[model samples]
Target: MTLNSGRGLLAALGLLAMAGSLPTFAIAQQAGQEGTPQAVPVVVAPVEMRPVAGALDVVGKISAIDRVDIQARVEGFLQDVSFEEGGTVAEGDVLFRIEPDEFEAAVTQAQGQLDAAVAQQSLAQVQLDRAQQLLDKKVDSQMTRDQAKAAYDSAVAEVKVSEGALRSAQINLGYTTITAPVAGVVGRAAITKGNVVGPASGPLTTIVSQDPIHALFQISETDFRNLRDRASADPDNVKVTVGFSDGTEYDQTGSIDFIDATVNQSTDTILGRAQFPNADGVLRDGQLVRVKLESGTPEERALVAQGAIIADQGGLYVFVVEDGKAARRTIKIGNTVDTDVVVRDGLAEGDMVIIDGLERVRPGAPVLAQPAPDAASSGQIPAAETEADAAPAAADDKG
Candidate 1:
């Protein structure tokens, strides 16, 4: 019986030893499984520095410098029209003619009356002199002398009145022809031949000066203030460039010609005007255009891919790859150019920023850097690579 009990005890000891060995073997297998290196795929873009200019592009319209409404100054019936519709004319060019026969006849009648008055005055003067001589000889009475003097004065007054009438008739006759007041392009005439036009008839046509033009546009209050401040710093720096609706750029540069004193109450925008030389008449009045207000010089700033930025609770941030790990960094953004953004702060040139797989990246995540595909390549970013980057670095080691 003692021998059988000793053998049972030995068997129990062997079982306990096997159990200890099993635990060690399991631990060794787990460590071996964790020794493999796993790569988490990610997309990266090189940081580039570029020039950024602070400017605001605004929409505007073109307008002529001088606009006039043509009207007749004197009352007359239009006898002949000499100007073609939409034709260019010079100052003092005859545009219309009124009938001058009545005016000329009035001048003739006034001249006849003045000649008769002059003859009567001469006779009256002779009568007065004769009366004075007879009074000296006591042949004429004082009453006759007074009568002759009165007749002479009346005749002289009539001559003066006729002369005045002749001058007025001449002026009226000259008013028969209508001439252009200023040199410009003439629009369609509102009145035709036989139409009586005068000051009361309003404008007979419209004219606009096209040698020089103005571009009118509105900008936000903020932009206006920025422009003013920049101008104040450097008196001759701010320049305005204009572009047409068809995307063609204007060669002539313009200066700020006008600024409204008061801001527009309804739109909160300020009205601005720029003067441009249009000697060739290339710019027309009331043409809609785009204005680029360049307030200052270009500034060197950091640039990054526009898609690399991610917005969340941390605000504008980018995933920077450092030491082969996904690092989240906040950045200050400046002006945007095409598909890239200018960084004012929080980034340096040549920093690798993740352009793809942002959804799978987080702080301290392990990332396998990959070049962004060129435009010629297929545009698909693989889903498996995205999933791998989303997993933890420790998980990568375990795999």
Candidate 2:
């Protein structure tokens, strides 16, 4: 390098270093030449008001509306199990058959005794009539008539006793053939054929009614009060729908039919039961399910798409374009319905929220807002594409 050129370069560097703000002044001049900053483009939609109802979710257990235990009413060897295990049975259908030989013999013996008693009663009545006739004709003494009357009365009492014994035998014979007390699905047999079963035996099996099944659940007392307030006439009639653990929803809806008389003090919850129609028998006893309750009259609520919601350590927030500038709004949210979320606070109807191109804008920055293609005044969200979701939308607007 030439000595003169090297000396000149060193002198320039020294002058620039001595006046450091000279570079900053030159950059400011360059920015002035560039004019105004361009406004960021954003997609926007309006907030909307829609009817919403309060909801509560709780776990439930399926139960039969009517449950019965089958047992032998008479003592004898079980000759047959007349039902298929886990099969449906109609009321009055035979479920078991105990050996009938002994019952039949007792019935026969009792019938014979009743016949003998009837014969004796007739003979005694004839004797009493003859004795009375003789006394009226002065051919028999009063004592003779009286004695005949006594014998007749005794014979009548014996006949009455025998009739009772016969009825008892017939009842026992009927009991030997066990019948279902209600129409329901039967569980596994506790005893098999050839086993001795009688009144002393425990339940031979169980039966649970299927249609109009019960879903048992628990609710806090506060919730019960809220539900009752929703429907004053029927506290238990609050509407409920069920879902399975696998996220499949039950087709039929249920209503609360019963509330336990007492509260479970330890848990501070009251037991509630909802009845659902199960004509297809899809609901089974002891099954677990999710129960969602809808209560209270529908109230107007502002709703926004779930995609517009943003959460952070400070809770949740969304963006809106206000006065031609991108604005941020912190929101308190409630239960979500479909893709729409209930906005409990921090937003109002007709608010233009910025939902897209959020990465290019900041709070209070100029934005070029455009309507989301699916946007509408109604609470329904415009279907969106191209990755901008989780906030409101806005485009540049003149203040």
C-alpha RMSD by candidate, in order: 12.0, 9.0
Cα lDDT tens digits, model 1, 1-399, are 699999999999999999989989999998887765444577776677777677667889998877888777668788888999988888889987887887789889988988998999999999999999999899989999999999999999998998998888888888888788787788998989998878898888888888778999998898788877866745246677787655567888888878888899999999989888887777888889878777666777788887888887768999887766778889988645556778888998777788887777877767877667651154333333343444555465465
The residue-by-residue lDDT of candidate 2 on 312-342, one tens digit each, is 8999999986666668999998765545778
| Candidate 1 global TM-score | 0.55
**Model 1: which residue pairs collide?**
none
Question: Which candidate has the top score in TM-score?
Answer: 2
- For model 1, what is the alpha-carbon lDDT of residue 45? 69
TM-score of each: 0.55, 0.64
lDDT score of model 2?
0.84
Which portions of model 1 show Cα errors greater than 4 Å? 1-61, 74-76, 117-160, 194-196, 217-225, 233-236, 257-272, 300-399
Backbone clashes for every candidate come to 0, 21
